[model samples]
Target: MIKDHRPYVVKRAWLKFQKFYARHFLRPQLTRLGTGFTFMRPWHVELFGAPIRIGRYATVIATPDKKIRLSVWPAQAGKGHITLGDYCLICPGVRISSAEGITIADNCMIANGAYITDSDWHGIYDRLSFGQAEAVEIGKNVWIGDSAIVCKGVTIGENSIIGAGAIVVESVPANCVAAGNPARVVKRLDPEETFTTRAQFFADPAKLARDFMAWEQAVLQGNTYFGWLRHLLFPAKGD
Candidate 1:
């Protein structure tokens, strides 16, 4: 069977176009956009207010309905800041709102529908008045699961994992896994085991990306245009 290289070529060109769009249109808007920052759907990333900085090699996967929102509210006492560190992966429906400050360190992976807020937004009784706002710090190499909420005055330590649907209200220790309504330390990670983070993927991104493309092309070698269309419309079994 004759191999078709058209799909591979088209995909490469589309990726180049997306990168161009992100650099020219989106990068200028942010307070600080570091080098090699990529977004799958850049249009879905909504940035409001100033002092929102994202570090190098960060990837954000956002959609229209599940937009990734990063906002910093101005304060009378001190300025609000939201800083995302290097090689972090932020999924769709991740809303990070800072009234005082919110800092997420390097190599962190935040799953979809996760909310990280530094303030209550409104007072308990006063309603109109703004509630207490404190700095929420998420340390390096943390993995926040789906639908988790990191509330005010919380510090999640390094190499920790927040389980799905967890609501973190207090400080989580390093190398531990936390879960539940008021996220508690359920298990501790083995300190002896060596783990790799997303940062390693971006270390040689160009070579890795080319390798991935080659693998994809090999997989779709005998696939026709019609076959591709059919796969999109009605996905194959076990796909």
Candidate 2:
């Protein structure tokens, strides 16, 4: 109950199935998707409208309780583009709803329950009308913390960190840490220090895959198929 009851082979099979589901069902919905991407529980990820583009080596994790939704509802025929660059991490409950455009650069990580929007779907006075829509730009290696809301016309600079649960309405400068309801600049990141991005982490994809499988094998050393079934049937306290 403290550990994964499924055997290593079962884990591998589950991963393979997830990948298969992504390729077969999830890929067709995307406007563009590059190779070597992992979408865990791909079915839980909802994609609507286009042009929704996601680049290579992206790791998107979605759960039943926390579904990742990318919805692009263009006001006009030529608008609404949602672009996520290479080596990005999209966690559970991340909803990106774009009426114009939302551009997220490479190596960026969007934490769980984060919401990025480009349009106020409802007007202030006229609740039925869709209000102004502006493009949102997120620079390279930017980290959007859990439950953060990035509103319209916001441009977050490179290597900046948006604090957890912050509501961003204005542009965030590079190499800084922003927090609070309006999300002010609380601290600035060290320009001298090198940032280790997702691009760097996935530099050697083959090696990383090998190491990951090796880790799974080691961690699920004594797990069995029967044990997994037992746990599913009657889960214990730790489980």
Candidate 3:
């Protein structure tokens, strides 16, 4: 309870199983799933209706309570598509529903509970009909904060940051931070400052994997099979 109780071998096996499950089951659902992509709790990642593509080294994390969902429902067939570029991070409870097009460029980090949609789903007067559609283009290294809602017809420029709980209805220019309801530009990011992206973080895939494995092994060093089982059945205080 306090830490991972599973033995090293068991945890390693579980990781392998998750990867296998993602490869055979989840990969088929996506139009294009790039190499070295890590989908933690892949079963909780839901992809509905196609032409949804994700680029290389993408990290998607989902939990049972907060599943990541990507859905495309066009007014007509082939009218909507979702594309995520390289080294993107999609956190739990992120829902991206497209009725037109959504293009997220490289090294974007979409935090937990962020919702990105390209259509209103219902018209203002008719109510039943799908409203107008406009494409949303999120440029490179953009960060969408937790619980932010990006409404229809918004384009977020490169290196822009959307603050937590912001409701974006209009376009955000490059190198700025936008927040609040109707999400106004709060501050301009200094373009001269150096920016480190997720792409750079995952530059060496093999080294990164090795580093994670080493850390896991070290942390789970004293764990045993029976200890793990006991913790699960009757967890102790500070377990």
What lDDT tens digits, residue by residue, belong to model 1 across residues 62-175? 998999998888554566889999999999999999889999999999999999999998999988877888889999999999999999999999999999999999999999
In terms of lDDT, model 1 sits at: 0.88
| Model 3 global lDDT (CA atoms, 0 to 1) | 0.94
**What is the overall TM-score of model 1 with all chains considered together?**
0.88
Give the number of the best model, judged by TM-score.
3
Q: Give per-residue lDDT, candidate 3, residue 123.
A: 89
What tens-digit string does per-residue lDDT give for candidate 3 at 209-232? Answer: 999999999999999999999999
Residues 1-239, candidate 2, lDDT per residue (tens digit)? 57788999888899999999999998999989999999999999999999999999999999999999999999788999999999999999999999999999999999999999999998899888788899999999999999999999999999999999999999999999999999999998998998999998889999999999899999999987888899999998987
Model 2 has an lDDT value of: 0.95
RMSD for each of the candidates: 3.5, 1.2, 0.9
Each candidate structure's count of clashing pairs: 0, 0, 1
lDDT (0-100) at residue 95 of candidate 1? 97
lDDT of each: 0.88, 0.95, 0.94
Better of 1 and 2 by TM-score: 2
